[model samples]
Target: MITKDVRNWLGALTFLISLCLSGCQSGNAPASSPIETNRSLAPQRVDIRGSILSSQYSDGQVILEVERLSPSPDSRYDRAYVLVLPTAQMVDSEGLSVSISELRPGQNVAILLRAGGQGNRTGIGVARKLWIEDRF
Candidate 1:
């Protein structure tokens, strides 16, 4: 007859095996392609300096037409990026916190972007932080 300790150990081992098997099985979920998995895991960060073409305060969105100053390899030339800004931290030229309504057309701004979804190639980006520049 098995001892109480042996019985308990066997039960724990069986439970662990079942847990491993369940984790290994994907069930009804479809497998994601390697590219899609990589994209979801890591988002690229992009920094850009441009002038605001227009802004919609109600929507918390800004349209920035890049001036191509110190362009990155991923930067698209002469593109207007429609950036979502509701969660972004905005600071003025004086480094004071500013609201979306304070932003106006023709104001030079430097923005740090978290490029996802269609990526930076499509000029679609989420603004992580924005600085209203006095000059570009």
Candidate 2:
């Protein structure tokens, strides 16, 4: 007969398995080739310095025009125009304050981006963090 402890353990194990399987389903089509399936999950850090081309706080994203920056190996994104997302830990360049309204268009500043979201159907480079320079 199964003990109470054994039954609880099986329930927990099933929950964990389900959680892992959910991550596998990204709702995108399967990779066409094996090479396409293998993508580095290493998070990349990119620093961009330029003027803000546009800012959309309502949409929770920002677009900046790069004036001077290094090229990224990921060909899925355009280095000239970058999309910035506001994370919960998002802060200013000083790293003391967290304010999304401080960002405005036509302001010259530097942005630090932590790259993510590749090979999951959305190959766009998503920023995991942002460090906005003091300009608003």
Candidate 3:
């Protein structure tokens, strides 16, 4: 049998424990990991060739949605990026840092776009060479 004061103290203690546990869980919130996907070949062996329909920057990389317009009788879309490898983070050539604006639209370029996740987006990217892979 606990007194009223003792009961209140227990309740407070319980509440504090719960709050601590919740804080730990919330703190460990997972970040966006590009490597955690079925497609592991991303950023390692990505050799894509496509025509840039449009390019934009997101999260740090160049989000380029291109059109594989030639090889096929009908064109298909392939999304890619230009990012830093190994770290799976977006960075520019020269191993520095870059943005989507660098890869301007209306520009024909072929990049090593890492095979993305379920969204068909690439992981990291490398602007190996631009305006070189002329399928014309």
Which numbered prediction scores highest in lDDT against the true structure?
1
Q: Please give, for residues 1-136, the per-residue lDDT of candidate 2 as tens digits.
A: 5798899999999999998888778655575633223221222334444456665555866655544323445323333355666663455544455556776776544444455433332233444555454433
* TM-score of model 3 vs. true structure: 0.33
Best model per TM-score: 1
Model 2: how far is 114 from its true place, Å?
A: 3.5
Which wins on TM-score, candidate 1 or candidate 2?
1
Q: Please write out the lDDT profile of model 3 over residues 55-86, one tens digit for every residue.
A: 66666555565555345322122555444322
Compare candidates 2 and 3 on TM-score and give the better one.
2
Question: With candidate 1 superimposed using the best TM-score fit, by how many Å does residue 59's alpha carbon deviate from the native?
Answer: 4.2
Worst 10 residues of 2 by lDDT: 35-44
**lDDT score for residue 83 of model 3:** 45
Superior by lDDT: candidate 2 or candidate 3: 2
Q: How accurate locally is residue 60 in candidate 1, as Cα lDDT from 0 to 100?
A: 48
Give the higher-TM-score candidate: 1 or 3.
Answer: 1
lDDT of 1 by residue, 1-136 (tens): 5698899999999999999889878675577655343322111333556667766654546555545445556344334465656667888755578877787888776666675324443455667777776653
Candidate 2: TM-score?
0.39
Count of backbone collisions within predicted model 1 = 0
What's the distance in Å from true for residue 96, model 2?
2.0
